[model samples]
Target: MRRLLLLPLALVTLTLMTATTSAAEKDARVYEMRVYYAPPGKLDALNARFKNHTLKMFEKHGLTNVGYFVPVDNKENKLVYFISAPSKAARDKALQAMGGDADWKKAVADSEKDGKLVSKIESRFLTVTEYSPLLKVEKGAEERVFELRTYTATKGNLGHLNDRFKNHTIALFAKHGMTNLIYWNVLAGEKGADDTLIYLLAHKSKEAAAKSFDAFRKDPDWLAARKASEEKGGGSLTAEKNGVVSEFLVPTDYSPLK
Candidate 1:
């Protein structure tokens, strides 16, 4: 009689666990990366709009603000940020809602009254790579300097590059004191789907970043893995020149995913 009762309880527990797992899967978020190219002298105005009104308006439409950044080099007047929604369908619906919001429309008009702030906007949908460390919002994460790196793979070699990172490079990065935040690939962009990898890393400071990279480059394990992959894969996975772009950034005060 006791065994019969215990069997029912165990089945109930299993059913509940299955339901929770399904809910968690349904709640997984889709990330969007956006880059705004501010016109020659309008970067400050653009930033002001986001800082003052745009972000709040985004929240009103159910888009969760992730992080905001500006390139340290500043060659182009640009702003980059991330946001997430429950799913691609949800993301599209929320963005449409935000666009139709009266307050957001007014904010855009007011902010651009002087002139149009942005000239071009580039957007990409991304999914975290299978091996990527899940990003979390943590206290004191704001103090770290972030690096956004985009790599363009050599023609037909992206698979090789991904394998190297999946099997070796990611571990080497951790060994060198670099914090790997997330790795993603462009899902919808001008960049070829099979040839691009974009990722973010964090470091304690600029000096520490330089030191960490120096050590990473010299690590014997990394060197061996890189050489073997290049030889087996026909060549280096990345282009020989101008294939990698690295930008240093800092999180905005109100960024939720610091």
Candidate 2:
């Protein structure tokens, strides 16, 4: 299996799910989930079904999606996917609703009109840390976004990543209009809380996103600082375990910034 290396910076065209609630939480969370697949050759039919029938069902149901992610270099052994939800309770509500939605049932039936989508699909939920600031984004944010950057780390490297982020990149991004959130270590995927770091930047639109990176990448002082920290950490900028870079977009149902 080839490693998923490069990060994505495009608008993903998918999102869904909804629920009834009385009070909103103090801090909304960007609940993250990873769905793994069976195998490529065997999954063709299932894949077709998702593109055709199931994707619409999810939209029709109660889950409000932010975006979907495909590992940069997916081979077969391991596969990864992403979704965004407002809160854990909301997520639970959506999942419970799934158990009862007729559209989803029909979508599943029509797709598996042949067979199941996968032999097994496992998923985990995540909470966005308050400090990163992703949950605060309102619906209008889609109109202005920045980068969707992910930093992957192994067991010993999280401390290093944290230091790098706090001391430099975080500030640079903020200065450059890179908003819409912070860092997340894999909390519920394969390695759960031990394998990865994930986060997205919703900048002031794609053009601004391009300019922000250009300025950051071109600054010699910034480059030197990054290099110096890397040396002190005894390695490179990121730990690169499952170094995956993914892309995503907002859906109408759950966007907060409108």
Candidate 3:
């Protein structure tokens, strides 16, 4: 992760900076991150085959998972996995290699030949927006944490999600140690015209993040704020009401998202 602050005057500042910097620096690899939550009832079995057993097989074949995190707030039925890639080209190279790797081929055949653990997995591919920046992460740190969340507002609910977040969620996230990287509203590559909102959260480390979130969750003020919002119009999410289905993303390569 790298650190980038998006200021009110960000456009002016960024344009001036980019104008001054050479082209080579502009192409430095920026990973587009995604996070997904597993559906309920079948997650345990799914993890055995995918996250744990299959992911190890992935690492053997070069698909390195960056990390995993779950939502402290939304805990319906979800487990998250983070994926990484150096560059788009490198991402493709790795996947191509994985496809040809005997281990991956065998694992896929043995595990999924019958059928996938879950009927379908939700996915989102995000691109790093200019206004956002990934903070440089340090290894062997006391804590390493990342929060990958999506906003899936529909034709009407989009405004509410956007405005409410602009008015509240951003500051709340910032106040609670959730730093902004980049956010993608509707990055392409999903199966439909639109159905998801994508963003990333960078933390000092997972340990520090756990503690920070524990504090955030226990705060009386935060609870009250949320309760107050619910009193207004917070029931905007429903499978049929919104007519939206979304897949969270862990950043990967060879994507159509931009």
Candidate 4:
């Protein structure tokens, strides 16, 4: 009789655990990375609008601001930022509501009275990878330079590329003094969705980043993993030309992640 009762209790616990996990997955946020290109001298005005008006407006509508950044070199006058919502449907609803809000419209008009603040906008929706840390609202312990990396996998090799990272690369990164912040895959229906892996890493500085990568590349474990994975994937996993793109970014004053 005790065994029978134990079996039922065990089954009940298992059911509860599965249900909880499902709920957590359902509640996970989908993130959006947006890049706004400012027309020449308008970058300051664009940033001012975000600082003075837009961030609050976004919070009021249930959108969570992640971080805002500008390229370290600052050649293009681009503003890069992240935002997230509970789910894609919720994201659409919040954006629509914000778009229609009277105050939002007014703020946009006022900011752009002289000229349009942004000349071009590029947006991509990304889903967090299984190994990535859930982004928190808390800031880092120290000021850091963030590097955004975009990897384009060779045709039909994305799976193998992800396998390498999941099993070996992330650990080696930490061993070499690189802090892995978040990793993502572009959502289906988006350009590069099938071939792109985008992730962010925080470094002590550009010099630190360079030093870290140099060590990482020379690490025996990393070399073995890379060789094995490439062999399994049939040649290099990434495209031959521009396979990897890296950009160093500095956090804006109000960026939560910094």
Give me the candidate number with maximum lDDT.
Answer: 4
Whole-structure CA lDDT of model 3: 0.48
Using TM-score, give the best candidate's number. 4
Query: Which regions of candidate 2 are displaced past 4 Å?
Result: 1-30, 34-97, 100-124, 188-192, 204-207, 240-258
TM-scores, all candidates, are: 0.83, 0.55, 0.46, 0.88
Model 1 Cα shift for residue 78 (angstroms): 1.2
How many angstroms is residue 205 displaced in model 4 relative to the true structure, after the best TM-score fit? Answer: 0.3
Between prediction 1 and prediction 4, which has the larger TM-score?
4
| lDDT per residue (tens digit) for residues 6-74 in model 2 | 212111100000100111223355455555575546555655555565545555555554544343334
Query: How well is each residue in 1-258 modelled by candidate 3, as lDDT tens digits?
Result: 123224332343344334323332342442434334445555555556664455665566555455444444445545555455655566667778878878777766676654555544455444433333333332323333445655565444544454444444444455566555444454345332154555666677556566766877776655755565544545553125534333333221211111
lDDT of each prediction vs. the true structure?
A: 0.77, 0.52, 0.48, 0.84
TM-score winner, 2 or 3: 2
Q: What is the C-alpha RMSD of each candidate to the true structure, in Å?
A: 9.6, 10.5, 9.3, 8.5
Candidate 1 lDDT over 8-114, as tens digits, reads 43353344334433443443577889999999989888888998998898888898888888877778998999988887788899989989989889999988888
Which residue ranges in model 4 land beyond 4 Å of their true spot? 1-27
lDDT of 1: 0.77
Across 1-258, the per-residue lDDT of candidate 4 in tens digits comes to 223224443353344334433443553678999999999999999999999888998899999999999999999999999998887788899989999999999999999999999999999999877666545555788889999999999999988988777667766666677877788888878888899999999999999999999998998878889999999999999999999999999999888888
| Regions of candidate 1 where Cα sits further than 4 Å from its true position | 1-28, 139-142, 188-191
